[model samples]
Target: MEMIYLDNAATTPVLDEVVEAVADCLRNYFGNPSSLHRLGIRSEKLIKEAADSVGAVLHVDADEIIFTSGGTEANNMAILGTALARQRTGRHLITTAIEHPSVLRVFDHLKSQSFEVTYLPVDKSGLISPDRLEKEIRPDTTLVSIMHVNNEIGSIQPIEQLGRIIKSINPNTVFHVDAIQSFGKLGLYPKKWGIDLLSLSGHKIHAPKGIGALYVKKGVRLQPILFGGGQQRGYRSGTENIAGIAGLGAASKFIRRELETKSAYLYDLKNRLVAGLKDALPQAVINGSLESGAPHIVNIGFPGMKGEVLLHALEDEGVFVSTGSACSSRDRTVSHVLKAVGVDDRIAGGSIRVSTSYLTTMDEIDAFISILASVVSRVEKYSRR
Candidate 1:
């Protein structure tokens, strides 16, 4: 049986076009971008062109994009760099309780160094209220970091509204957004959204792993986390991953060209999957605010079954899904995102996230639903025994 992959949120398969781009770069553009020779110039041109492509997709200047080793590094650089740079101005930061470990861990690290952090709570729908945020703003608050979309639950955050609130309260406070899950899936215009720093991952959108970009609005002040040759405008150092960067560019271009069509297709797929699951298992509950989420993901909870048992049983039947974000899968802890959204411990532990991509097919989704229904039925039966 062919395995049906429903874990696009963890990482997507590199598209054929992106793979070809990377392979071509590896074959022909191996020279160090820093060298002053013809080979180096060729490599440098490719890197710059890649940056330009990604920047064009987001409607930003190429100079504003700094390449990093995927979203984690970009998040670290954005939060840490901004916090450290603005330390003299203020030492207070604000973020949500449902942020990815990358952002949360960076704030944790800052807390260790004497910076004060306020982790704002989310509502039952996994949303942070702008009014609550307004209440949390302090004279000393220097930065507000939030994710554009919740990774596990697929709930869309009110980024533009939140940005306006933050700007109104503290114009000097940098507003950074982790758009790793939303960049390609949603319409993301950092300038229009009033975002000072934005983090995006290539791997999340069919680009090769190990390449991502951080969009630093032109006037934003950020301290360098890495030191070496003055690459990435001296913000991020070391030699650029020419091939991976090229692939990222290609991936961004692909998404720009197909975003609308793919988004609609994904919406249809999600609706079909959710409807099928609901019809087949009435006890199953769809979590999160469906109307306010990205159309490509569905988080569902089976009332009497462990999510891990269902996950492995589906895997055994050639269906692949996730209990939560791949980065936190090893911990076996209930999803922090679900808990933040007020899901009871019993239901939260039984929640599984099924995320789709533009490449996922309806047939595969149906197959997954068939297998999942059977798996949940078996688990429910076993529970009685």
Candidate 2:
């Protein structure tokens, strides 16, 4: 049985080119980016070139991009750093209830410090109201953090509009976006979108894990999160992960060249799976707004089935998907995103998230859907017994 990997929202497999780039860096450019030797200069140059590659994708200045471990750290640095830097100016912040844990938990930590945080509720579509967000922003509101694409339900937030709302309401209030899931699959223009800080993860776009970046608009001051060797202009300190950075750069360039084509292909695959599932299981309910969701992700719920049972059943057929964000898959917590979008706890329990990548195939989608129908049938039979 050929394995069909559809849980891309959790993580994507690294591309062969990315793997070679990382290996090449590890073998040939194995110098510390902070060292003063000639090899170090080459490694440092590699870092700069990689930054430029990622920067081009965001349409931002290369100097504004700061490398970090991954999306979580990028989100942490943006939220915590901005709140700390602007605390004297304001102790109030705003975010959505459906943000990835990285952004939500950071706000929770700040709340413990007496910062007032207002969480915007999503409609059935898993989207925050711009008017509500604008009303939350005040002269003293320090920052607003939102994710571009939801990791669970695949809802695409109106990030550009929300960014405009935050800036228009209070120019001093910084806007941070966790674009980890949307970076390579969608168009992200920080400057045009009025985004002050945008977080990205390399692994989401076929680059290696353990490397990501934060785009801090020039003149936006954020307190340093890491203290070491005074690297990354004192924003994030530590010896740079040279190999990972090289892989990220390689992935960014490749994605940039293929983005338009890749996006169309993903949409084709997603639509095929959705259509197939509906035809096979008429009672299957999609969790998010089909009109506004990302092209690479889809969430479906079986009215009378448990998600885990269906998930494991699919696994037996060489197909893989997830119950929710891989970061919190095993927590046994109610799906916060589904709850926010008004999914009953029982139906939410039956929800599965199927995410695709550029490499996913139409044939794989068809096979998974056929396998899923069979699995659901067998599970239903056992349940009726």
Best by TM-score: 2
For residues 1-385, what per-residue lDDT tens digits would candidate 2 score against the true structure?
A: 4799999989899999999999999989988888899989999999999999999999888899999999999999999999999999999998899999889899999999999999999999998898888888889999998899999988999888887888888999999999998999888999999999999999898998899999999999999989888999999989998898999999999889878556587778878987898799898999988889998889898886899998999998889999967779998887889989999877889889999988888888888878888899999999999
Q: Best lDDT goes to which candidate?
A: 2
Clashes of 2: 0
- Colliding pairs, model 2: none
Candidate 1 lDDT at 216 equals 96
Model 1: which ten-residue window has the lowest total lDDT? 257-266
What residue runs in model 1 are displaced by over 4 Å at the alpha carbon? Answer: none
Candidate 1 lDDT over residue span 1-385, tens digit each: 4789899999999999999999999999989999999999999999889989889878899999999999999999999999999999999999999999999989989999999999989888889888999999988898999999999898899898999899998899899999999888888888888899999999999998889999999989999999999887899999998899999999998998877556588889988887888788788887888888888778898765688888888888888889967779988888888889988878888888999998899998888877887888888888899
**Cα lDDT for residue 320, candidate 1:** 83
lDDT (Cα) of model 2: 0.90
TM-scores of the models, in the given order? 0.98, 0.98
The C-alpha stretches of model 2 lying farther than 4 A from their native spots are none
The local distance difference test score of each candidate is 0.90, 0.90
